[model samples]
Target: MHQEPDFLHNLHQELRDGRRWLDRSIVLAYAAAAGLCVVAFTLMADAGFELFQRIYRWQGGWAVLLWLPAITVAAVWATRRWAPGAAGSGIPQVMVTLDPAVSEHQRSRFVSLWLSFSKMALASAGFAAGLSIGREGPSVQVAAGVMHSARRWLGPHSGISSHALLVAGGAAGIAAAFNAPLAGVVFAIEELSRKLESRSSGLIIAAIVLAGLMGVSAFGNLSYFGRIRVPSLTWNALLPGLCVALASGVLGGLFAKVMAASLTSPAERMNRWRARFPLRFAAGGALVIAVIGLVTGGATFGAGSEAVKHMLAGEADVPSFYVTLKFVATWLSAWVGVPGGIFAPSLSIGAGVGHNVATLTGSDSIAPALIAMGMAAFLAAVTQAPLTAFIIVMEMVDGHAMVLSLMASAMLASLISRMLARPLYETLAHHMASALPGPASTQDPPEPAHAPGVPQQK
Candidate 1:
């Protein structure tokens, strides 16, 4: 056999070592991105909460009427002018970017670091103004941007698939935002990526672990909705569970349908009006929310966190109309193109609905179970992602014992929701994909031969 050159053999060995190093480096980069996202998102959420708390304390509901319209106009203008890509719940943007039909350029248009920063700032501002949105969805977009940008930074040495980074970033974001790692995993598999590639298993886990640790360090190991000590379910619990599920499913389905309808292009009268005069329409939505806040004693404000907790603990004396008010607020926020999310508020709505169910049935003992089911059911109805809905609720409330109940509610609600509306994210994603520019040519461009100052070969 011909002798191999020593230089060639050494180069080969070096290449293999470099490949191994790059692989390890990619993992570190992913973990770092996840950790950074968790910290930034936590601070963003806390700051938004503090802003609303202080403003409300100073003037209460009247402040919303005064501030919300101006805030909505500024926020809407900011989102449209500076970061149109960051508008609305960001999960749809991620989902749209992941579609195979969308070109890299189109994906980058919406998921860049610039847009991510805009999302964080605008979304926090919306929260501060008591927009009925959540921090969770925007966090997903921000985290995904961190990882997506990593692909550009690492160049050929990234050793990470672009799609994988998007999925991992979103998964890790959910894990950190709600302190629910398992739900993150399930969300990645069931919704974000729609498939868990075997090759990416370790990478996804690393990001989740890093983000989860960061969240724990900052917020401690408390459940997003606090731990609910659900007692053993009796036959009595079943009736209320069914009632809550049916109500949440039907109502959540209608909410999804109306929301999707509102987001459509200007062919529809409602969407046309919103299109013809966006600022005015947006202000109207804000005004409606302010009026609801005034009527509900602000129960419908700020993602409904306090009201949900109170209702879940069976201590809230919230108005009978609060659930409807919250659902309408969420719908209006979606229509007005605010930068926050429905994820947190949706659960709160479900909890409120469940409390109503308990009241109607005259059963306090099963309130916790009913509330848990309502969360699973309504979220499932809205997103049409049953597994994600149940797993998230199970993780959030630490109600592992009610897993079966939650799952049943999720399935039933999803089925019922599909009857009323297309999957919310999926419909939005389809619209996004349809609206994107045509794909670029597949042929590769010629490579540069030298650095900027160097001459090219003749």
Candidate 2:
């Protein structure tokens, strides 16, 4: 016994030591990747804002409308030519990487990463073109893709471990984008990855903290919406707040249903007109332009952040007509096959709706609170992720005090929306994937044997 020294035991001990070292290395890699994503997104967002401002100065109000058509055409062309998988929100594509329903050919980590990058670029371009979209979701996809690539290159043997890193990167992306580490971690757990293991939790935390620190160091610790102070809470206000929350939830549900229905029907129609995508997009762009020209005097075409600011600053009266116009414009722009996101536009709509309610109630002070609540509520309703929605609004507005109301609103909205329709991402993914050829007919290219991570369901 002494001579043999338990050979199997010695081997097991060595393997355990190796695994510990690998885990440490993976954590370090996650931290670095998270930092990089924070810097990239911050710089990109700042530069994108400046570019849009320049375009506005040069082309006048007409620039906003022109952006819709131009970006739609470009995004459509790029998707069809370079990476068809990147056509929509990169979330669906990421899901495919994990599920591999198509075939081995489509399951390459390289394809996932490349398609994600292309989509990120296109989405950024679309935003710079003055389309009403947000970079957060795209950023999440891009970060995950980058981490996937890194794992493939540096830790090829760590397939299962790499999934942890992918989640870490995604969390870091959200943290970097919003400068809210806790919210980012929660989002990764609740929305993107949909699962949390003990080991992965530590990795996610490290990534989020590092990414948030990087964002703060680079951008001077600025919140996405600056600071929003809530008024004193009162027992009397609770009832009104509840009523507002209920209404917002119902409306949010209805909005999500309408958008999903519109998107699915038109996308189906597009199958027949796939050959003329460019022209169709161009025509759609022209329509966007005309809508802006007529309704907003050319003001409501872009991300509507400026409009939100105006409403918040008490500089403008948010009329129903404007809300309706923005709603229609964003709906059409998204429906017409443009590579954009719904977050910003949804916030804009929420703000407008909140302002309208405030005017009706003759209370300016309550508007901001209502706006925050409505933003979360409506988003929760549409996305069907109450926790994510609540955290997103909290981070977006820097409203910690309103967390309770935000939670209430979000839950109500999610419940109502569920009753009205399916979750936004799920519906979109299902409709899009259903149209594609079956896995048997379309096999993915050969690739490394990456572990299929758990798929995130909405």
Candidate 3:
């Protein structure tokens, strides 16, 4: 039999009621919100995949070259016309929302909702047309927007409460998209929210768990890439793995620098030229399509998840040419105004690099380890979130045994990238947002000292 509460409980009630009740209600509300988010994301992913399959069957090769450009133009135009803040990864918009400098007029609920829908529709269409982008980033924005919209019915104070739920929804979306619960939670903390307060942590964790459960129930308990088997670890392979990690990290840093330079240079140029915006964007789109066709033979278009799986399975034997193609494709995709996430493409690039290195060295034993390490290293370098990168890969591959090497690689890559320059997303967003006309401010608000890159003030 259960025992009743004792004198301590009675004393607690005597201490305070308002704070205690509010805390309890917040926890309960968050739990409910997280559960709802999980259900929504699961449905969305299934629908998105089906829609993409149908589009692929209908479009054929022109999917990448023609349809992608058209959709990209529409999406870009919609963002520029209605929701300029949603132009890029959407993370920056979230940062801007939290910025104190942003006036109330700019932070309208309608803007968030419109941006969310546009991102979802455009990202979904991009995936359907085989563009090199992932769904995770867009999903985060969509989910957060959904939570934010729900605040209207929950009362005025719901906006304040929605912040926590927004983080939760984002975590749920990531978990559902990638089937990585821990990574979702870690990412929400490390990359997006950049806060570890108890309220936030509790909500995010709750959301991740609910989303994971929903994903398993609907999609089965499978890693994003299925079962990635790593050969048994050995001391002899350690040196080569380390070397691969170091190289990938350095290269990843250079990649981040390249993206930042591309984004910022264009902004600087725009200031000088004051060029026609649509014409410039269209030209960039055309260039991206041409480069993708030339370099990848059209293989690098879209999310590149299939290509990544092929690399992991050791099915592709194209040599360094393959990695080079992917790198170019990814760069072009980003350089153009395609609304998508780089995480998957980055992983594919890393895998190709690792696979090429292994082939050159004839070190089959260490190839898998190197591939995994390369992914962590490159991602850490680009995003400047070493721990999040490590955990994300570990969760995606379910490779707990590879943790030590992943950690080492992530640290090396993140350090090298930091030495090279700022985190890619922040730098790109800052410049791009600034270049746009209107009342929007370009300067980032004072972020928490501990927050990665730039902090968004509450």
Candidate 4:
């Protein structure tokens, strides 16, 4: 073969190198765009809740009771009519899209810009409706959708898999939403991917950093739940910590069990009824949630993030049955076919459990510590992703001093949760995967069978 000149070879090599850089730049752009989307999402969610609060303050309980059902009816109707895939905690949808068996055409319906936008808007409506739902889970889908949108721009030759995009976007969502970069990374590894590929490590970190920077710029560098001054763990504190952990484990497990049962009810008739009369069903569920809110003096409404903050600050005076009532409220909200998440509500419920445990044990001095532990343990139990749960709680509370205890509590609670319910998100993902059209659905590897019904578009 004739030898090419060195200059020609160098020129070709430079072109190749330039293309690689361009591809990387595109990915960075996607990451940055995802972060911007999350920031907008956070603002929208907060604004919705603020509007609801204003309405409540203006007209009192009657207005709230009416607002919830009416908005929920609208939200549920809009969800079913337009973006059915946007319903519920969107984590499961993202999880399903990651399945290699799911074709790109199929995955588009699950993770696309339109679906993500609808999810954000509808979830904000849920917040305005005083639904006991969170934005964190929806954030994952939104960011994933934004990140995944680059597929057409960067062809298959770009060496970036859809898997990497989805994972990065989802992780970025967590980082931005909670302002916890490390927790975001751990969540990607522990919950989203189960195992992070070495090739994706740089991408994941870059996404998290970009998203987290956006969060910091918009919200300030503060803990998600505000920091607490926890005393060093001592033998005297062990008993209280353990009690909180046990309580969180059982309660969280119960919540998981009930959730699984509600979603995967063996009663096909009920599912049919719900499908046929989605508006009526949503209205009914909304009515129950409104009643729960009234009974709890509105403590159980709107994801309970504020309530958890109040408890941590020792400024809350929750009802004795707050935990159970909030649990019912969150579950009903999810059942109402609205677009929202359980993450914040779950943390609130955990805080209530911790409060009750501290009160029962007369450990007021260490209540904050117990509350932190409960948040971690219960989340761990519910998700069965102990590392992610613990890291989230740790970051939210700035609880470095309580690291060991939080880890222990999360591990124990996750173990106990397994005894009562299978991994909640994975099981739900399995249900969703099984519902996809085509033979690939049948080829999904075995996963936990005990899952609830997924939000399917009619």
Best by TM-score: 4
Q: Supply the TM-score for candidate 4.
A: 0.93
Q: Candidate 3, TM-score vs. the true structure?
A: 0.81
lDDT string for model 3 (154-248, tens) is 44432245556566666666676677778878877776666755644654576567755766666678877766778887787777777777777
| Best of the two (1, 2) by lDDT | 1
* TM-scores for every candidate against the unseen true structure: 0.90, 0.82, 0.81, 0.93
Q: After superposition, how far is residue 421 of candidate 3 from its true place, in Å?
A: 1.5
lDDT of 2 by residue, 182-261 (tens): 77788777665677667557656776778778777877776667667688866756755666667666777777787777
Pairs that clash in candidate 1: 134-341
lDDT (CA) per prediction: 0.79, 0.65, 0.64, 0.85
Which numbered prediction scores highest in lDDT against the true structure?
A: 4
Give per-residue CA lDDT, model 1, range 25-134, as digits (tens).
Answer: 77557657665765786688668867776777675447768787788888898888889899988898898777666778889876888988888888888887787888
User: Ten consecutive residues with minimal summed lDDT in candidate 2?
Assistant: 445-454
Q: Please give the distance, in angstroms, between residue 281's alpha carbon in candidate 2 and its true position after superposition.
A: 3.3
